[model samples]
Target: MVVNVSNLSPRLRQLGLVAVLFGAIPAGLALMGGGYPFQVGITALIFVTLAVSLNLVTGTAGLLSLGHAGFFGVGAYAAALAATKLHWPFLLTLPLAGIVAAALGVIVALPTMRLISIYFAVATLGVGEMIHVSLLNWVSFTRGPMGIRSIPPIEILGLDLSGVIGGYYVAATVAALAIFAVHRLTHSYYGNALRSLREDDQCSAAMGLNPVRLKIEAFAVSCAIAGMAGAVYAHTASFISPDSFRFEESILILAMIVVGGLGSLPGAVIGAVLLIVLPEVLRGIGDFRMIAVGVFMFLSILFLPKGLLGEASAIGLARRQLGAAWRGDIGAGWK
Candidate 1:
């Protein structure tokens, strides 16, 4: 893997290493002092994971899914059912929730594989709403809007992760792994092919790539990752209701992906973190928080067209290009 990464452009390799280091900061903090408020960071980190995984499908594969929260809701309910009805442990329930969500993704992706752009997004929106409605109406399974309470704290071996501090560690570790997996996936051949399809689907198909299969696979993987986040959230919060997985959550996820920048893993992480933190940072404004959030989002888009991280990268590249030109390297200009 080191050799493969080394073969990339020096800038990309450096950027990747720097990103890995930055992503590990949460774990480093968890090893030291942390408190319940850290769970808010953990929730934000889960958003980071969800956004990165969704980037795989939307940013890389040119596939848009508005139904992602459906998968999240599914994972939450599945874990709840497992823990309460089946008497299964939370550990066992979480992964099962992921599996269930992945299976649903596969099912949804199969019929929608032929869709593109707006039609696909609209279809997913409807799908997400449908599931949410079912979750609300299905009192027997989801316990309806009344919700399930007293969700047992997750226990790994004999260690109870009942404390918010412990939950932060678990959440950070899980979020880190999820992001790393996305990073690895995006650098693999599969990622290359997905990007190719994103750039030009006809061209990719002409090159003998099964665009349908790839899109479906990306969709499934993205949903599976989101489901994992949702499952963890269920246990961490120890309570869930239909209102929890509302359509607004879907919008927030989309906003995170977009604000972070398209087709950039680090961008996704940045977006999730800022979007999560921005609201809290605006606490001084009280009733004006939402306005402040919108203004920040607008300025970020206007000033940094590519994204916060992407613009910083562009500056670095420009400096590198200037240095190369001064040194009389291969080219007088950089692309």
Candidate 2:
């Protein structure tokens, strides 16, 4: 079942909107007060943006990329270089990072167009490793292992956003914008084309949709959004290195999309918040923290096979309810 907001009942639509608006309150409060909690909020917003961007390819286009961190790193480096070397303003660097990352996405997409499923995934993993090595080896450009330092914080229109409060606001605003953009994209005809490609590329192509073009476009858009998030992260933290955007980071992001519910927008946000906050919440566990995390994920997969927000199981429940209604099963609660 394709779950479009327009297809939902008016009451459900209003409820969803209310829930979305209310969800912003906690983050806003955290930002209003600066502290460790505020810091965590900033990081959560960044991950939220990344998760949404990754969903474009992984969820909508059904492309499992294991190297999204490569594009993310590219964006961070691009922003850093522009700020440190070219002395560009923060505003300019944001788009520059996205453009550079999108270019890399195109490069990656071209070679992997003929591949799909596991083959495509493996190729992306290799691409991520290549980026990591390049960042480590390209000393003069990326400053090698020492990473970029003293990177200036975001400033716009005579306002400096280096403070925790300002940083959180910026991160939240960017994340909100990213979510809105994805929502618009996913509701359009183009989104349907991507979904069709995900369901069956050959069949979509037979119906006159161009799978290759759609896939490449999705990848470019997704990576570009990731790059924007990276730029925000670099400016907010005022430091970035290749280690920050490694294979493990990619895996964590993949986990966010999966645990949140693949192909669900709200799922991206939920997954980002849950996973990013989960580690912090588990800090008391000390040596066994990761074990707990692994066990939790195992159980989630075992139970919510399609993910927490995935439609497959929801559709099943809906069908059961309708069937019960047809048979006059009053206890089923269907009027």
Best by TM-score: 2
- Candidate 2 TM-score over all chains jointly: 0.85
RMSD (Cα, Å) of model 2: 7.1
RMSD of 1: 6.6
lDDT of 2 by residue, 1-335 (tens): 77976567645764675465445655555655647777788899999999999988998889999998888899999998899888888899999999999999999898797798899999999999999999998998899999999788889877988887788778877888888788657644677688889899999999998899989999999999999998998888888888999999999899888987888777888889988878778999888888887787788889987788884543343334334343453322222
Q: How high is the lDDT of residue 67 in model 1?
A: 76
What are the lDDT scores of the predictions, listed in order? Answer: 0.78, 0.83
Task: Compose the digit string of candidate 1's lDDT tens values, residues 1-335.
Answer: 25664346656765665565444555555565666446667778778878887788887787777877888888888888788778788778878888998999999889988888899998888888988999999997788889888777788888887887667667776787887677657655677788889889989999999999988888888888888888788888889898878788888787787788777777888899899888876788899998888898888888877775663453344344335432444332322
lDDT of 1 at 264: 73
